[model samples]
Every structure is written in C-alpha cells, then in structure tokens.
Target chain A: MSELAQALDTLARRRLGGDAATGLARMTAGATQEIWRFMLVKDGAETPLILRRAPGGDRVSESATGLEIEASLMEAAEAAGVPVPHVKWVLTPDDGIGHGFVMAFVEGETLGGRIARGEAFAEARKVLTRQCGEALAAIHRIDPAAFPTLKRVTPLEFVTQYRDGYLASNWPRPVFDLAFRWLLDRCPPPPENPRLVHGDFRNGNIMVGPDGLRAVLDWELAHVADPMEDMGWICANSWRFGVEDKPVGGFGLREELWAGYEAAGGEKVDPERALFWEVFGSLRWGVMCCGMANSFRTADPSVERAVIARRTSETEIDLLRLLAA
Target chain B: MQDQPTPSEILGAVARFLKEVVVAETKGATSFNVRVAANALEMMRRQLDTAPAAEAAELASLKALLGIENEDEGGDLATLNAELARRLGAGELDLKTPGVADHLWATTLAKLSVDQPTYWGYRAALAERAAPTET
Candidate 1:
C-alpha cells in the first residue's frame, strides 16, 4: 500500500473504527491541500469520505484560517443555513494524518464553466445569482464574536498585502502599478460594523446541482472585513468563465444578487464599494498569478505554476477594463 | 529561411496533439496538467506571432512617455518598464498625466491580444476602444 493509503487505513480504523479504507484515490490537487477520497468500510457499510490536508504535513496557508478553524467555520456556516458537506472528523496528531479534517464528499458539479453554461443547470442559473447573494449574506451574518482567532482585515490592509507582494516581485507592471494607486485613491472607509467576509467566494469555489447552490466550499480564506468584499469578489471578471455579461458568476445580474442579499437581511448593498472591490479583485488575482510564477521560479517548480505567469496579463487587461469603465 | 514547419506551427501541432492524445490517455490530475501544458504551448505559439510587433510598439510608447532617448545603455523593455513602474509608484506619472493611460491601455491590450485574446475583458476593451468617443 502507498504511504498515504496506509495512513488512511490506520486513520479510518482509529478514528471511525472502520474495518478498512477501500478504493483510495487522490482528487484534483488543490493548490494548498491534498484531497484523498476513499470508502470507509465499517460493519459491511461503505461510507465515502474525503481527507483535506495541508501538503507534505506542512501547514500550508497564506492569509488563511487554519484547517481546524475551517472545520469550525463550516459547522457555523451549516448552522447559519448555508449548504455544506458535514465535517466527519477533525484530524489529531494521534491520527497521524497531519493537520486537516475529514468531511463527507460533496456531490455536485464544481466546474464553473459547466454550471455557467450547461443545459442541465439552465434552470438553476436563473436563480443562482440570488442564491449566491443569499449565501454570502448568511456567511456575513455569522457573528465574528464566535471565533476569536479570526483576524479582521481592513480593505486597505488587504490591498497593501497584494501591493507588497507585487512590489517584491521586482517586475514593473505599469498596469498593475496604476491599478494599485487607483484602488488606494478610492479605498472605502471600513464598514461601521465589519462582518465576516467569505474571502474566496466565487464560481470555482462553489458547487452546484441542477437544483442549484449545493455547497459553499473553501472557507479557509474567510476573514472579518466589509461584507461587500464578498459581493465584489463573485462579480469579479476572472470567475465569470467567459460569461462576463452576467456580472454575478456569469449567470445572474448584479441587481439580482443585491436584491437577494437585501432579502436575506444583509447589510445594505453599496454599488460604489462593490465596484471598488471588483477592481481590487482583479488586482488581487493578478498579484496571485504573478506570485504563482514567482513560486515556480524560486521555490516549487511545477508546470502548472510556470504557465500561470502568462495569466498575469489576463488580469492586467481585466484591471484596464474595470478602470476604463 | 529555416524550415517549412515554422516554430509557431510546430508548437501548435504539439499542443494540439497533447490536447487530443495525452488528455485522452490520462485521467484526473494528469489530464488537467496536460491541458494546462497544451495551453502553455498554444499561448507561446501565439506570443511568437504577436510579441515582436506589440513589444516594439510598447517600447516606442514607453520611451516617448518617459522622454527617454537612446543616449544611455538602459533601454531594455524590462528596465524601461521598471523605471515607469517606479515613477508611477513615486507619483511621478498617473492616468491624468498626458498619454499615460493611453500608453498603459495599449500596452496591456497588446499583451492580452496574445495571452488571452478571447477573454471577455479583452474583447470588451477592444469594443470600447473601437467605439466612437465623446468629443
């Protein structure tokens, strides 16, 4: 058995008292996490489960809530009536699988392209923007008082982090330079009552069924900030998957999303601030793309990372488009 | 002068083969990586065609905007861009500065014409630029 397979077997036996872990296979590798799917056989019953862990036993995160917090946030999200896969177990050192949690595998199409354009989801598309808005409102409404570890990131701090990373790259991106200054010039004052922002709320991070909005995934990026950040992020051009006309994840209008957010009692949706964050979102993704390429050169050498360098130009154009309008 | 199958054509062929053959042969992570690999080749192929002209135009525009003549030795694209970025960061140049926004837009659009021509933002920008402007 492979080392990970053995670990899974041992973990299943120790944690769930399963007889064995069968059909173990790795899922599509997320940038930071190793996802392994297996069926835990216990008392002749097979339970499909997923192990989401930091790569190489190193706690992999950048401005991320730790795995333990991620699990807790999911539980809190479920309590707030957001769709989520039930977390089955949180890994302990005794389990020997490093830092991560086991959760029930969510069954749905997570592909942004498919959900945006697939005929199967045509009906779901009609209401998905509103659904996403509602989901974001739920996430924002989750009181930060519950989690003491969570950091409250101001809009300026968030932009500065990306700016620092970009400047460190030592690559002179004129468009990026302009975009950063523009964002800073118009940075909105921090919200009177900051709320939890689903930091990576966008198309690829969400899962959808034909019925719609099955699970809101990848909560590690969650932090306390202006809730409008979530609103702007979903409307960012990168996540639209080519359907840019529909500002809400390529399937719904901005007004629809705002309406849904208001219907769910979210803080009043501000169009100007939302636009500010949308521009910020493009710069953020551009910085991240450049960072990936930097990682390929300086640390991790992967084909995926190297090619991503070209995508920085994509964001450059996106920033120009956003700013031009 | 070299061969009938030019370097650009060669890259395109290889990318197509990977997308058609390797993707069919592999599943999951390997398949995804192969697709990205194919995309990289296709993008490079496109860059080969578009970069020379676009970069020349960009360099000319950068020199004009920065008032840089070929007196000193530091005129490479990267070095010039770095200077421009530094000036922008130091508040020397901004969008309101004459030709700054236009230069940035043209150069960025030139890059997108190679990297992601089909990207909606790129297309939208083209459409906007082509549209009749207010007097």
Candidate 2:
C-alpha cells in the first residue's frame, strides 16, 4: 500500500473512529507538498477528506508556515466570516504522516486558464472578482490576537525580508538588484494595523464555484502584514493570464473589486501604494521563478519549472518597466 | 567565401541532431540515460539557441540606449559575453530608470522565445486578469 493509504488507515482508526474505505486518488500539482484525496467510512456513510504531506525525505522550510499554523489561520478566517475550507484535523509531526494536515474537501474549479478563456465561467466571471475582493477583506479583518501561534511581520519588514531573501540566494541578476532598489525607495509606511495577508492570493490560488466563491485554498504562505499586499498581488499583471485588458485576474474591473472591498468595510486603498506592491509582487514572482528553475538541479527536474525560470527574465523586465514608470 | 560555423551554430547543429535522433531513440534504449541525457541536452540546446541572439540583441540595445556610437571593440561573442556579464554583475543596468523599459522589452522577448506553454499560459492569465481592471 502507498504511504498515504497507510497514514489514512491509521488516522481513520485513531481519530475518525472508523476504517478507511480506500486510498482513492492522489493529486500532484504543488511542487513543495503532496496532496491526496481519500474517503473514510464510519458506519455506512462516506466522508471525503484531503491529506497533505511533505515529499520524500524533504523537510518543510523553517521560515514556512507549519500545517498547524495554517489550520489555525483557516479556523480564525472562517470564524471571521471568510469563506474557506473547514479544517478537519492537523496531523502532528509524530503522526508519521510527515508534515501535513487533513481538511474538508471543498469542490470547485481552480484552473485559471479556463476562467481566463471566458467559456464556462463567462457569466460567473464578473461576480467572481467581487467575491475575491470580499473574501480578501474578510481575511484581512481577522484578529491576529485570535491566533497566537501565527507570526506577524511589519509591512516594511516584510518587504525587507523578501528583498534580503532573494538577494541572499546568490543568483546574480542585475534586474533583481534594480527591482530591490525601486522597492526600497517606494516602501509604503507600515500599516496602522497589521492584518492577515494571503501571501499568494491570485486567480490561480482561488477556487470559484457556480454560486460564487467556494473556498480560499493554499494558506501555506499566509502571514500578518499590510492587507493591501494581497490586493496588489492579485491584481499584478503577472497574474492576469495574458488578458491585459482585464486587470483583475482576467475577471472584472479594479473599481468593481474596490467597490466590493468598500462594501466589506475595508479601508480606502491607496492607488500609488497598491502600484508599488504590484510591482513588488511581479519582482517577487520573478525571483521565485528563478529559484524554481535553479531547484531543478536537485529536487524535481521538471521541464516546466526550467521554462518558468526562463520566463522570470520577462517578469523582471516588466517589474523594471513598472518601476521606471 | 565559405562562411565558417560560429561556436553557437556548431552547438545548435549538435543539439538538433540529439533532439531528433538521440532523444527519440532513448525511449526504447535505457531509462538511466534518459533523464540525464534529456537534461543535459536541454541545457545545451538552450545555450545554443539563445546565447548568440541574446548577446547580439543585448549589446545592440545597450549601445543604442547608452548612446555609445563608437565601434564596439568586443566584436567576438566571447568578449561581448564577458562584457555583458561584467556589466550585469556590477549592477550597471539601472532597472529603476525609465530607459530600462527597452532592456525589459528585449529580455521579455528573449524569455518568451524559450519559455514553455505553461509560462505563456500564466502570462496570458495575468494579462487577462489585469485588463478589465486597468485604469
């Protein structure tokens, strides 16, 4: 049996008070973590659950948000009225399941390409943008005090962290240096109140359902900082998926999104500050793409990642142009 | 006059041969050699395909943007590559300046040439997302 199946069986007996129905299937998309879908039977009914685990012999980064922390953040966000997947249970490191967590399997479409193509989701696209804005506002409004385990970084410090992290990686590229300088010069004053910020919020990161937004997924990069960082990241041109005309993830207008934010009682967003973060978002992605490519030398020699690294030059260029503008 | 093949041209021919013959034959041959050969082949192919064009374009653009009209002493590919590397390493590119847009456009084009479909798809997605929201 697969390791995941064994873990599921063990967890079912220990926690769910039943037996695992089957291994079901595994979904492999994330380069960093392994995600599996399984079914558990407790009498005659079946409950669907997701299992996330670290890859073979790999350990989670020290700086990364742990599975327990992510679960806590999700719980807090849900309590604050944010639409998110209900946390089932967090598997402790001693569970022999590696570092992972179990959560309710929320079904929805997550393909950014399909949404951007304007076919099945054409009618729902306009509403999805507004939904994203509202969802983000709800997440930002979460009380940091509610989640004591979660670490908070000042907005300026977060910017510095990204800047220092990329440079310290020792990948020599002049464009990144330029982007760093621009980010430093344009650092917005720290937020008056720090709030939960979804570090990787974008079109691809969100799952959209027929009704509207289903659940916000991938909180592995979550943190507490300036909420506008999330707004700027979602609207960055790199996340727009080639539909230059549709700035809000190929979905709706910025004003529409902002309107939704205002309705959710979000503070007035500064356009200039948003632009700065947008540029920084692109720069951060550029660095990540480069790192992904470099990583192919060791773990996961994916052609796709190598391709991604090559494309970072383009993103870097975009950031440079934005900085210049 | 018979034009001799440049170093990049020679490498390109070898890469093409490897992709067409060796890579295709490897499917039936051996698994161990498959991944190693494929990765090495890809790197070689990328270098062969991109290096010359990238170097020439970068030099021409930099010269034009910097307005250095004098004939470049670094005419050969090696010298040009070294100079480009030096300039980039020394942080002379000035990415925050408006003039960097030309460099960015050029670099973007270079990257677009080699990036896989997923990268293009992501770019398309980002552009689509940004369009309706553009003010």
Alpha-carbon RMSD to native, per candidate: 2.7, 5.8
**Deviation (Å) of A256 in candidate 2:** 1.6
Candidate 1 residue-wise lDDT, A1-325, digit = tens: 8887888888888887799988988886676887889999999999899888898765667777889999999999999988889998898887777899999988899898998889999999987888998998888889899988898888899899889999988888988888888888889887788998779999989989998999999998888888998899888889888887888888899999999999998888879998999889888988989887779988778787887777899888888777654
Superposed by TM-score, candidate 1 places the C-alpha of residue A259 at a distance from the truth, in angstroms, of 1.5
Once fitted onto the true fold, the runs of candidate 2 whose alpha carbons sit more than 4 angstroms away are A17-19, A56-58, A93-96, A169-172, A298-302, A320-325, B1-50, B60-104, B114-135
Model 2 / residue A279 / CA error / Å: 0.9
Interface RMSD, all models, one decimal each? 1.4, 5.7
User: How high is the lDDT of residue B124 in model 1?
Assistant: 79
TM-score of structure candidate 1: 0.91
How does each model score on TM-score? 0.91, 0.78
Query: What tens digits encode model 1's per-residue C-alpha lDDT throughout B1-85?
Result: 6877899999999999999999999998899999998988988998998889998888888888899777454578999899998
Weakest 10 consecutive residues of candidate 1 chain A by summed lDDT = A55-64
Local distance difference test, candidate 1: 0.87
Q: Please tell me which predicted candidate would have the highest DockQ against the true structure.
A: 1
How many clashing pairs in candidate 2? 33
Q: Which residue segments of model 1 deviate by more than 4 Å?
A: A1-14, A17-20, A57-59, B1-35, B69-74, B132-135
